[model samples]
Structure formats: C-alpha cells, structure tokens
Target: MMADHENAGYRRLFDGDGLTFGTGFPLTDNRTSRPPVERELELAAHAESVGFDALWARDVPLYWPRFGDAGQTFDTWPWLSQVAARTDEVALGTASVVLPLRHPLHVAKSAATVDRLSDGRLVLGIATGDRDPEFDAFGVDREERGARFRESVDLLRTVWREDFPQVEGRWGDLDGELDLVPEPTTESLPLLPTGHARQELEWIAEHGDGWLFYHLPESTLESYLDDWREAAGEKPYAMAVRSDLADDPEAGPEHVHQGFRAGTAWFREYFRRLEELGVDHVLVSPAGESPEADLQRFAADVIDRL
Candidate 1:
C-alpha cells in the first residue's frame, strides 16, 4: 500500500524492508517556549546529511501553560516549509495536526501549498486532539470531537481529490461551486491517523492511509500489530519513543516516560526487537541537555550501524 504513494517521503521512509529512523523536531529536551530557530535548521541539515529518513514537527496551537512542552514552538506549515527549504531530500512530517481544532479547508490549503512547495515530501499525521482546556478555548465540544474528526478527514480527502466537491456535514457544507486550488503532488496526500482519535481500530484501518501509534511495550506492540495486520493488511504502522541515549555504549536501559534511557548498544538491540515486532518506522525523540550533540551521536553510533 505504501507503493501507492507517489511522494518521495513515503517511498523512502515506509516502502522499505527494515525500519528507518526519523528525529522529532525541537530536537531538544528544552520544554520551554521557542527553541532556537537557527540551531534547529542547522541540526536538521545535519540530520539529512547523515542519512536520516525524515524530520517530524508537532502541531500545538494554543500552548496550554499547564501542559508545558510547546512542540517546536513554531506553527506546522511555516516550520515545515522552512525545514523543506533547508533540507533537499529528507522527508517532512507533522507528528500530527489536531484536525478537530482547525477547519479542514484551511488544513487542505496549507497542506497542498506545502506539498507542492516541498516537491511531494509531506506526510500528514492527523489527530482528534488531546488537551481538554484547549478544546474549551477553541469553543469545540470535546464530546463531539470524534464525529468532527471523521467529518474533517472526509472533507480533507474530498477537497484534495475532487474539483468543486460537494460535501455536507455537521462542520459545514460545500455545494461544488468553487474548487480548491493546488492539488497535492500525488492524487492524495498521504495521511496517518494518530492514536485512536476516538474511532474504532477497524474504522481507522479502513479509513486511514496508515496508522500512527504511540509507544508500547514490546509484547503489547507485537500483539497489537498482529491485530492491526488483520484489519489494515500492508498499510504501514509508525510509533514514537521519548529516549535519552546514554554516553556509555554498554549502559543498560532505564525506563522513562513512553521510552527509555539507554546506551547506543542497548538501543540497537531494542530497535531490532521493534523491527521484529512489525514496526514499519520509528520517530525517535533524542532527549538530552545538548540535543545537537545527542543527535549526532545517535546518527553515528546507532543509526549508521542499523
């Protein structure tokens, strides 16, 4: 199914035999406001030069001070557009765009614009949203987010693939009078639905281009993938881990939130286990005081050998 995508991003990252690694943006452990823009660009360029498969950004609209982390502290479109400009070949992705919080038309337009500009290197990961206060702030009923999420996905696909498409839903309606401009580089932009988004696993498998999942233990993930394969069949599954790679090569793994703190050798064995569990790709968050140095070490020590 990944071969169905014409985009270089999907082809390079998901259409391969073994696992490929990508680093999440902000590339730092600084859970503060904005990350240094110049440093991010420089590190991104470094990531590309080292044969990293992709670079991912998160969409955090209104930073809930209570929630902390600002998610690269830059808007998804402009940040990714800038990332696209800085790197020539590495894939660009949104770890997710909260679809329930934004209008699908706006999302479609921005996505199309970026895809066109990037020469077909965008991979969109969509979500139903997680922050509760932010939902109230956006004036959207959190209870109805699931329905809205489904409707938004439908709207996005229709807009991208049809001319003057007719779409009527709880969100809004289009009478097929005016068509959207700048269609995606491919017939449809590749979409990976993050988490359940309040939908059934079957619904996700049936509707989404791929599945974007959060970190799980090895046993749990292996069993989950078995169920996923039954429903989704050849469609790819991607997951992320919040990792802190230790300086010592043989340091054992210590559990952390959603991931672990380990050395390069431990990570190497762990990733090989992930591949055996049927994980198609991984978004690795290199957590350290010096993110740039950590990333370089990760590339040279772990990824290059893998």
Candidate 2:
C-alpha cells in the first residue's frame, strides 16, 4: 500500500493500528462567509490535549459569496505554522491544497518550510482546483487543471528529493545548477490526493503517498477501499465526515452534508464501523454554535468512546 514515508504527520496517522480522528478548522459551522477564529488556536491546542491526532486546515483560495463559506480564512501557510507553534505533536494537514493554481516550486518551499517548522508534522492533501471562478481568477483554464495537477505533483516530489535536480515541465525547467533548499526533514512529504483530483484512482494509488477521499456510503466506501487495496496495497485511506453531533447520545442517524446528524452513541458506532472498513484516519468538520465546547464534547463523548 504505502512506502515507509517518514513524515511525522503521516506516521502518527497511518502508522497506528486503528482509526484515528482529526478535526478541521472553522472548527464549527461551515455556513459562514467569515468564521470567528478567535478561539481557533485555543481549540486547536485543546483538541491536541484531548487525544485528537491531527489538526486540518483548509485551502479555500477565494470566498465565493454564493457558497458563503470561506474555508479557514487565513492563508494555510501562516495559519498552519501558527497551529504548529501552538500544538506540540498533532499532525497538521491541509484538507486539500489547490495545486493547479499555484506553482510547484512555491509549494515545495512552503510545504517544506512548514514541515521543518513543525518538525515534519505535515501531510499535504492536494487536488486540482475545482471552482471555475478560481480558475478564471488564477487565469488557469479549468480543463487544464488535470494536466497541471499532475505536473505540479510530479515536480514537487522531484524538487524536494533531488538537489538541483534536472527537470522540466509545463511549469518550467530546473537545470542541475539550482537547488530547492530546506528539503523536508523526512525522506519526502506525504501526498494524499483528495477526491479524484481529475486523475484516475490507479494514478493516485501509484503516485500519491495516500488517498483523501470524500465521505461516501459504507457499502460504497467498502467497495472503494477494496479497489484501493487491490491497486495500492496497504497505503492508508482517509476521508472526511461532516458531523452534526446531536446532544442526545441515542439520537438516530439523519443524513446531512455528506455525513450525518446523530447522537454521540450513533456517531461512536459509526466511527467504529469505518475503522472496521479499513479506514486509517478521518477528518471531522464539526457543526455547532460553540466550537470549543462542541469539539471537546465530540472528543469526550464520541471519539473517546470509539
């Protein structure tokens, strides 16, 4: 499945035996155009203290008023660095960075910088840019994203691993003279492609360090996991679950936002079920009014039980 990638973040996550839980930023309420992040750092540290394994940040480049949700708001680099400084050991992740919009060399530097700053606690979840407006703003043709994504991903791996490595692509060429400094502390960074990223599963299985799939039904996820196992071996499989934790522990399941609205009891069982299905890690985006309280409750009530 996966090679022995020494990324601290990837190791802490996929290296474990059972399913592990991590929470994403905008810690609560995914509907706001601007998230109140005053306590976000505090919640992040608290989440680490409470047994959460990772802290994920989103890379929503622009706020589309129609969508009314600006991901974590702050640029992922500084934000992740801040989170890295606040927490000691939790793996810090980007839900998925839009690769087509940015240059690979920049990604290499930034990602490696964060990796060094955090002592290798970085797992990059990458994807082709999805929003059309984003494409237009970045002047990248949407149709070209698939190709650009592949180029960037390939280039990132090469640049990080080789010193002044000879390479050329749609982005540019690197002669054997110039090197990208500050190599990642590990052999290489962990690359988890989100969704399809416009590449086939086979491509992802081969090139990516792991996979970051979106939420899917149990049967569907099981089938997908089978395909992944067959193609990728034991490489870790991760997914996002939009959770609306009801106050009642016995609350039954109600489908919502590619996830569920359920009591702690149901959610706990659900997570265990996912673990049984061979899921390595889950990134949870909690929805509630009081994010800090909601996160703590979710950890104590659901994650703890699992």
**Could you say which candidate leads in TM-score?**
1
Q: What does candidate 1's lDDT look like per residue over 140-195, in tens digits?
A: 99999899989988888889888898878877788989888898888788889999
What's the lDDT for all of these models?
0.87, 0.87
Tens-digit lDDT string for candidate 2 (45-155): 888988889999888888888866788788999899999999999999998899998888999999999999999999999988666798889888898999999999889
Clashing pairs in 2: 1-233, 1-234, 1-235
For each candidate in turn, the TM-score is 0.97, 0.96
Candidate 1 worst ten-residue window by lDDT: 1-10
What's the CA error at residue 156 for candidate 1, in Å? 0.9
Per-model tally of clashing residue pairs: 0, 3
State the TM-score for model 1. Answer: 0.97
